[model samples]
Target: MSSSLLCLVFLFFTIVAEATYSPGGFHHLSSLRQNKKASKSKPKLPFETRYFPQNLDHFSFTPESYKVFYQKYLINNRFWRKGGPIFVYTGNEGDIDWFATNTGFMSDIAPKFRALLVFIEHRFYGESMPFGKKLHKSPETLGYLSSQQALADYAILIRSLKQNLSSEASPVVVFGGSYGGMLAAWFRLKYPHITIGALASSAPILHFDNIVPLTSFYDAISQDFKDASVNCFNVIKRSWEELDAISTKKNGLPELSKKFRTCKGLHSQYSTRDWLMGAFVYTAMVNYATAANFMAPLPGYPVEEMCKIVDKFPRGSSNLDCAFAAASLYYNYSGSEKCFKIEQQTDDHGLDGWQWQACTEMVMPMSCSNQSMFPPYDNDYEAFKENCMSRYGVKPRPHWITTEFGGMKIETVLKRFGSNIIFSNGMQDPWSRGGVLKNISSSIVALVTKKGAHHADLRAATKDDPEWLKEQRRQEIAIIEKWISDYYRDLKED
Candidate 1:
């Protein structure tokens, strides 16, 4: 990989990991539900949590490969009928329960379709560790944590589930958002016979191998702010240089600490930059139509709300202060947090697993140029490689994702072999830059929404949902119905 590719890889993973897995991170949707005040009338959870004995290594024949670990999953069979179709949520980088709770669309439609809802936790995430905490101790142990292995796990589990339930004739539809969405699409491609269809919302399967512009991700983020408020966008773009200048002066760090209300005071510009960047990137990811608690308790159209805060600053106010206020809207929206901590440690196992994956097969290259709102940074593959080697005793296989999943010539490749896969993307999401934005074939369809952010379509329906969002979900359901109907028709014909 080129140095530019390496820089992109670092930037992409750093933002995603921090947003999705870090404590109080931007994409911690489950935290929202969990943090809500409990009520006496709170409804009981609909699904039952269970575990499966998953193979450590599905390909190798060694003794260690035969070792099994208990993988976690959740199943809700209340709406299932005999021979009903199965709906599975391929879990992402967090706990299965978080996804299960946040993804209300499935539950909303389960009764209508008479489908059984199942959420399978990805191996090494949540409570599905193959080798416990020691899984991260070496490359050999972490080698079992690839996407291929996780896909195989899903396939085997689905087959076994069908057999146990005596529903081998039942059709299966998989649902995932973001990384899980990528898995959903690949599962259909790699194991088409196992699943009838996939709903891959905001899956950036085209992020690898220079398939998309290196600056597209940051550019989309910049555009989101620009769309919200041009003045807010310009303030952020100019504030970086101002921050740099302020950091060099005497008592500058303390001044920044006072302005940003940092809990541990400012040490360097890097942490402050990262902290601010996370708020922007994550807010973009979950910028739903209505107020949402996906990342934090944020108002409706959070990017716009953040922009409103920035634009409200008085004429003589400092741009740095304006930026901090905007970031605080994301970080302190609930008004519960006293002071912002620049860095904090977390016990999330998924973070560890993701870092290992980023160091290995999950390399997606990204870089920013002068044209982007972000500061220009050069990619350094040698430095990236050395850092990976020192930390994990491994080198990143930057080409492995495309090699395994087919990012290059994706439309042609998928049109030839893929079917019943919905590539749904919200233009507001930065990840959408690497997503399939056009229809590949009749069965392989792309559903693009301009105002949508991240996996807005996968979230549970709310009365506050915009008409376009509601229509998107209805179209998705209709497509899945056709897939199930077609599968049964084929079965009868055969």
Candidate 2:
């Protein structure tokens, strides 16, 4: 194979290694169901699942443009009053039900504001497949799946729903976490006339282009480990060298398979490295103050737990052994997974759709160096382009996101036109490296907490929530309340 092909292959392995722990709400659904079964008093689901007919191609004029698909959405009008604010959770890469269930902040504060709750599923995900399940069969069908198209879908759906409910007078506020957060913020920017404001939590809107350092992501992960324990960070940092030395010895791959308790034999050292990297990265992402099942069954302060395991390793245990034990905590925390699988498979259509998006417009660059806890890797755009072309017959538009979303001079542009948007980020989330960390204008605000995890503020409040997290949510509620109050005051004046 050519050098470019080799690079692409390496990149693919790296992505596949991490695919098992990719962020989404699907896992939360299973957890929620389990919790519900355990409860003696089973409560009715908060929102009613509904479908909306959406255009296949929102930006095109071709025959395919007129085609329609049934997009899934959930609605709860229990707290809605006449002329009440409409709170919409812009769906991310997974099922709308998952988001609606996990995003309890919207429901928690709905009654106080008398807001109507709506969560819309993105196209090609959940049951919103534009061409049904065959949408992934060809590039032509998958072409309809893009952020721009999804944003348009939201704008049109909000308009239609308002008209149907005679809610044209109701102010719309969009809420989303992670990628959905990006959509929520972009929705307000692109269709300000449609939405009064947006609460975008953990949204890395500036991750595209060269707006932030490519190393910012891995650096954040490294910092999380370093903060937990320097010794733990050093052990992980030196692990790659130890792994390389071990793999070159006799029966090395088999020894690794046995040590890690892999269900399947190890094929290459790179896969092992990728698997370990995924554990560290994802553990850092969901290192909540309280125990969380977002990625897997993890204890409260999972990073610290992993560090404690690494710090208290047996006297004769090898670095590789310690690493496996820590990683096991992430993958097999429930102690049910008999053996690790280096390769992972998912039936999530949303992830399949996300793969296409990552290849196309959502091309955020990430790399690691000596400064990071993981092994060093450079951001190779050419290699990424070759990989995307090989898989999808298209080149990634690295600059499209910046062009379409206004990444350059973002503060200046958004400060001028943006209003009533909350950019809330938890410092521990690696994605926060690319988030807006400060206020852009009086109306545009950023709420950042050092102890926060990925979109922790957006998750349901718990009895064990840290006081800081509670304060963060309280601040968000207050800001949103002001926006609604001001909107009504202005409407009365008009």
TM-score, one value per model: 0.92, 0.91
| Model 2 pairs in collision | none
Off by over 4 Å in 1: 1-44, 347-349
Candidate 1, run of 10 with poorest lDDT? 1-10
lDDT of 2: 0.77
Residue-wise C-alpha lDDT for candidate 1, range 53-118, written one tens digit per residue: 988999989989999999999999998987999999988765677677668889999999999999
Candidate 2 per-residue C-alpha lDDT over 1-494 given as tens digits, one digit per residue, 9 for 90 to 100: 11211111001111311221223422211222222212223235687889999988877698979998899998999999869999999988866776666688999999999999999998888889888786465788888888899999999999999999997999999999988998999999999999989999988888778788977877998999999999888888878788888888999999888877777897776666666766787788789899866656689999999999999986666777787788778777777767766644344334457667777887777666779987776766777677778888998788898898898988899887778899999999888878999999999999999988888898888999999999999999999989889999999999
Which one is best on lDDT? 2
State the C-alpha lDDT per candidate. Answer: 0.77, 0.77
Q: Against the true structure, whose TM-score is highest?
A: 1
Sliding window of 10 residues with minimal summed lDDT for model 2: 4-13
Which pairs of residues collide in model 1? 3-379, 8-366
